[model samples]
Target: MALVTTTEMFKKAYDGGYAIGAFNVNNMEIVQGITEACKEENSPVILQVSKGARSYASHTYLMKLVEAAVMDCPDIPIALHLDHGPDFETCKSCIDGGFTSVMIDASSRPFEENIEITKQVVDYAHKYGVVVEAELGTLAGIEDDVVVSAEDSSYTRPEEVEEFVRRTGCDSLAIAIGTSHGAFKFKPGTKPQLRFDVLRECEKKLPGFPIVLHGASSVPQEYVHMINTYGGAMKDAIGVPEDQLREAARSAVCKINIDSDLRLAMTGSVRKHLVECPADFDPRQYLKPARANIKELVRHKIVNVLGCSGKAL
Candidate 1:
């Protein structure tokens, strides 16, 4: 009915063996497409905003758009969250500005510093009945403000997870097992496989705790082909496989972040549309199909990947 925290949703998902899709939103069409699909699927969803998104569309406009989505879909639960919040000020801003959840990502910092900052955010967010998500290990690839090289990316140490959760009191933890950010997640010859051994070890360390996977987009080849077919140049842009993501969902992973896939779907579809309809000049004429494609992609994720369809109240 209204914006809510991920607490209850994560609890249910942890028990139900499904993950909630946390899709990044930067504009009206992106919000509309994601919510409409979640509405149709009867699934709980998270609409996350990055600092870049807030800067691009302005926080006021994005909040208003999410409010419109809440009005449009009154039956489903939607959590408005800040994705990859870089600092305490940003986290505080989001918490004060009506975000239901905010992630404090200090993974780039040292372990003690990460705990200190995350604890600060957790204390503030809990005071306002908002949830906090924190990151432990660093992820590779570029996405908005988050960028780490392959040499710097590290898998989350299972041994430290229990202590981190205990000290930080974060609602969930985003661990970098193997998933990287951006469209070009992996190199050409490398096999894409998550360190489930690492994941399971983390689970063992923190039983029943909600886990999050960032850079989880699949980078569907269908959309890639469409993009390349229509004069786009994205080479070797592979992502985490969908089946592996589904497997993760059936484990301790309760939230999966998706961004690049939506971008690809929208971009590829609109490119095809413009190429086919060279005479069309209206924004709606092109964005209509793009929005529709996003909706379908999200719906497919709900039904086939995340397995959260019909889980919303």
Candidate 2:
């Protein structure tokens, strides 16, 4: 099948008490690993590209890689999404370039301005049969080009959701409820808790609407340890607890964004492989294990955290 929009996937996830995994993709290996895992688990996926990713690997290259994935994995539905689009031009470019979905992240702007910008993109995207995702609150930490300090980050106001959605006409809303970008989601010795009350209030306001969670990567400690063991020093690299993410999935959250975990898994695997086999100088020798680890990490997420495994079938 060809690429699809997130409308149907979000609807089913909302009804079935699960969330689709929206994994960030930058290169061919990452694309292949994520899609292979989703194909094996029989789960739908969203392959997201960020502005920084587009800069690093040109837009055409990323689009072609996604197209390849679609041809390779024909059984399951896949959506090509632009993650954290900073402006209307970027969103429009993605919509015009054949992205199935695009996110206009204007949360940092004033509420009125955010609505105006998001509405502009939504209007243009709908004409081309593409869906738009909008962000309501700011998230802390760094992810590609998105960066907000902890003090600057705020939880999504449940009261503003109704009017925001009504005015913007966005297909999905991303809310911040303690999940932050990057691996260091929380400080050491502190328990990370998602504000379910805030989430429930938003759900009450927009009962059937699809909700999204950005910066939702659960940075596995095993990968951190692997990286440290192989000449890396990343201290206190923590993430949202898997149990909390699982709870969020059972709620109105239809799409959970995960990038840090994929990075950690791949980086750690490559580090270990190169450390153990110093004689091997081939790129494939190192990247093959990294790709395998990414596949396993995504498979674990599909079955345990997102609970969307076998749903595609």
Candidate 3:
């Protein structure tokens, strides 16, 4: 089939008590690994591209890579999305460039300004048959070009969601509940808990509407250990507990964003492969394992965490 919008996927996820995985894609290996897993698991996926990813890998290359994935995995539904779009121009470019969905993240701005900016993008995107996702609260930590400190981050106000959605006309809303960007989501020696109270309130307000959670990667400690064993020193790299994410999926959270996990899986695999086989200088030799690791990680996520496995069929 062709690339689809998140509308139908989110609807199914909401009804099925699951969430669609929105994985970030920057290169061919990443795209291939994610799609292959989704295809095997029979789960729909949202392959998203960020502004920084567009800068690192040209937009055209990413588009063609996704296009190829569509051809390679024709059975499952796939949505090409612009993740964390900074402005209307970026969102417009993706909407016009064949992306099925786009996210306009204006959460850092004042509420009124955020609504205005999101509305502008929503107006333009809906005209092109593209769906728009908007963020209501800023997330902490670093993800590509998105950087917000812990102190600056705030939980999404449940009260503001109704008006924001009404005014912006976005297809989905990303809320910051405790999930932060990157691997170091919480400080060491602290229990990371998502504010389900806040989430519940939002659900009460926006019933039957699709909600999204950014910075939702559960940074598997196995990957962290693998990286450290292979000459890396990433300490205290904790993420949202898988159980908490599973609970959210059973609620109104219809989409969950995961990027750090993919990066950790690939980086750790490449590090281990190169360190063990120093004589192997070929790119494929190292990236082959990295790609496999990513595929396994995605598969685990589909079946265990997101609970969307076999939904595509």
Candidate 4:
């Protein structure tokens, strides 16, 4: 099957009380691992490319890799999306380059300006049969090119959602409800909580619209311990509690972005593999286990967190 937009998937998720996993893809292993798990679990997924991913692995390479995944995992639906697209140009390029969906992240701009820029991209994307996802409030922490200070971050105002959607015509809306980018989402001794009150208010306003949660990865403690035990220094790398994320998934959240956890899984596995077999220098020797870890992580997410397993064709 061809790549699909998130429209139908989000509709199903909203009605069925589940969310689709929007995993960020950087290389062959990541793409293969994610898609393989989704294929096995019978869950639809979004393989998203960020600006950094496009730079690390060229856009052409990523597209072909996704194409390969599509051919290999033909039973399940897959969507190639541009994550955190900075401007209309990037969104347009993705749409023209065959991505099924694009996100125009203008949340860093002023409210009026964000609406204007998002509307422009939405207009162009809809013309090409591509769906657009736009962000409302800014999220803190680092993710690729996206960075915001904690002082600058703000939760999405529920009141503004209706007007923003009415004006932009975006297929989905990403709202900041305290989920931040990167592994260090919260401090070491603090509780990690999402403002479900804000979320519910937005849902009440935007009723059936698909809501998205960025930086929702639950940084597994096992991966963090593995990385540290294998000679790495990562401190205070806490993420949104899995229980909170599961609650969000059961609500209006249709797409949950998970990048840092995947990075942690791969990094921890590779570090442990190398530590165990110091004499081995082959890339596959380490990458094989890393890939397996990513696959297992994705499967766990599909079944336990997102609740989308067995929902795909």
Candidate 5:
């Protein structure tokens, strides 16, 4: 029950023909909810810590929480990952601080600069036996403090992926394939589509290499309704369709990022419980159900979206 790097997970996922769910972890309850679901499903999971996560929950607390998860679920294959590490210093710090996997997100910088930064991170991370994941194209949407509007988002050119992989020597590539960031990714009257053609082209160029999809959460309408019906106002909040995510997983895309759905699930339950039971003032009375809802949501993602149930040791 030790933490592992994404390299091993991606290799196994690439061979198994199913992607592992890389869920974002912000706090103790979120970590417990996700890892507990993983134990139930017998699926390997990645507990990704973003910059905001580190800031919100102190790095020491988050690390200790994951360590507690390892102790709690001794059989699950869990990896502590740094999601979207902005620069070499951040990536290096996470690697030094016990993160097994770190993503060098320089997609916002110039292409050559991005490569240079990613290369630097790779050199540093490899020294610590930490795996590095890099992004090729920019993803549009707001994730915590990072914000990229729709006009700025660009698809990853298939021609550049091969070169990016060669030049940077990143372990995995997180590519933008029409899946934007945030819950309200697509507008009310539009259907969200992942560019399978681009994925096919990348697979053609770099066979057997693991690919990653960001902002792939399918915002379940049931949760949305619960949130709205129970005093929350997330109207028309939609996400990438499950079929689209399933298609990616069946292909070379092996890591799917999901956060908003879990947030929605937890908030929906908490709001409902708060609205229906105004007399219940205890924090646990509300938080317990919220945690349970998040667990159910994670289990559903493993069984339905990722199809990774029973794969863990």
Candidate 6:
């Protein structure tokens, strides 16, 4: 009926052995596409807003767009989340702005500093009845407001997780287990794999706690081929394996972030349309198909990756 927190969602997912899909949103069409898929599949979803999204589209517009989605699909549970929040103020602002959850990503800082900043956000978010997700290990990827070089990428320290969670008091923890950010997740002739042993260790330490995976998009090759065929160049843009992500979801990973795949799908579809119809001047015609492409991507994630379908009202 209204914005809900990931608290219940993650608990159910953990108990049921399925992860929740948290899709990033930037505009109306993207929001509509993600929610549409969730509604069709009877799944609860997290619509995440990034700092770049807020700067590009304005906070008010994004907030109202989510509100409209709630009105459109009253049967499905949706949570508006602030993804990759840079600091305490940004997390606090989103909590006060009607976001159900916010992520404080201080993973790039020193371990103690990360805990300090995340704890600050947790304290502020709890006051507004909002949930907080914090990152412990730094992940290398190119996302809005989050960019780490591959050379700097490192796995989360297993021993520090218990202390980090205990100190921060965060609702969920995102760990870096060999999954990098962006479309170029892997290079050519290399098999993309996850560090499952590391993940299992984290699960053992924080039993029953909701684990999160950042930059876990299974960059579909079809979309890449489409983009390339339509005058785009994205060489060797490999991502996490869908089967591995499914395995993570069935384990302790309660939330898997997916942004690059959606962008690739939308861009590929739009490019194909424009190339086919060069005389088409109306934006709606191309955007409509792009919206459909994104919606299809969400639906596939729900049924294939996240086993949360039919778990929602």
Which lDDT tens digits does candidate 2 get at residues 1-313? 9999999999999999999999999999999999999999999999999999999999999999999999999999999999999999999899889999999999999999999999999999999999999999899999988889999999999999999999999999999899999999999999999999999999999999999999999899999999999999999999999999999999999999999999999999999999899999999999999999999999999999999999885
Q: Per-residue lDDT of 191-257 in model 1, one digit per residue for the tens?
A: 8999999999999999999999999999999999999999999989899999999999999999999
Compare candidates 1 and 4 on lDDT and give the better one.
1
Clashing pairs in 4: none
Cα misplacement distance, residue 287 of candidate 4 (Å): 0.2
Q: What digit string (tens of lDDT, one per residue) describes model 6 on residues 88-207?
A: 889888988899999999998999899999999999899889999999888987998788998888998889999999999999999999898899998899988899999999999999
lDDT of 5 by residue, 97-154 (tens): 9999999999989899999999999989898898889998888888886699989989
Residues forming the 10-long window of minimal summed lDDT in candidate 4: 234-243
In angstroms, the error of model 4 at 3 is 0.7
Q: Give the TM-scores of the predictions, in the order they appear.
A: 0.99, 0.99, 0.99, 0.99, 0.98, 0.99
lDDT of 5: 0.90
lDDT of 4 at 90: 89
RMSD of 6: 0.7
Give per-residue CA lDDT, model 3, range 32-121, as digits (tens): 999999989999999999999999999999999999999999999999999999998999888888999999999999999999999999
List where candidate 6 sits over 4 angstroms from the true fold.
none
Better lDDT candidate (1, 6): 1
| Per-residue C-alpha lDDT of model 4 across residues 175-197, encoded as one tens digit per residue | 99999999999988998999999
Clashes per prediction?
Answer: 0, 0, 0, 0, 0, 1
Q: What's the residue-level lDDT of 287 in candidate 5?
A: 87
For model 3, what is the alpha-carbon lDDT of residue 236? 92
Q: What is the lDDT of candidate 4?
A: 0.95
